[model samples]
Target: MAARVGLNGQAPRCDHIDLLPAVEPGLPECKECLALGQAWTLLLVCLTCGWVACSDDSPGGHAREHYRETDHPVVAALAPETAWRWCYVHGRIV
Candidate 1:
């Protein structure tokens, strides 16, 4: 969903970009527990449950791991000011 600034307030619009659906949604927390350690390079936002995970190429691959444990469906790049998300199934930006 795109963040919109309305006259009176802000609104969130679901752009609905085609992307690969996550294989799983209810994945266990990061096994390596890197989540508790250092900062991450990239953040993947789970469209299914809004769980944020680190990119697969990172130390833990928490993002892809989230997909393996839970079929949440959608994920977005969680970078600052970058609201673009990706769908794994469709391989498109959502």
Candidate 2:
């Protein structure tokens, strides 16, 4: 795999990519999605601190919230069949 680089051009280590189980280990099922009954098409993974949150503009804004609360450094687009991570601190696509 030719590591995908983020904006900063630094390639993130693929070893950090974690495969979440069907039932997420620690994340709470999106309540906003449940209340509005909307299903999320994509999930956001925080590479800076390894936090997983819903995408921006969602009811929870979990991803953004994570950034706000934790100040984690990076986040990447999480997909079932993909392995890639993004670093927020360096503004790179590693």
RMSD of each: 9.1, 7.0
Relative to the true structure, candidate 2 reaches a TM of: 0.48
* lDDT string, candidate 1, 8-64, tens digits: 464333344333344343333433446468455666778777677777667777877
| Model 2 worst lDDT run, 10 consecutive residues | 16-25
Q: How does candidate 2 score on lDDT?
A: 0.57
Instruction: Give the TM-score of each candidate.
Output: 0.54, 0.48
Error (Å) of candidate 2 at residue 47 is: 3.8
Tens digit of lDDT per residue, candidate 2, span 1-94? 6776545566555333343223332353444466667766556776644456677656567676677777665565666667655544555445
- Candidate 1 wrong stretches, greater than 4 Å: 1-39
What C-alpha lDDT does candidate 1 achieve relative to the native structure? Answer: 0.60
After best superposition, candidate 1 residue 34: deviation in angstroms? 2.6
Give the top-scoring candidate (lDDT). 1
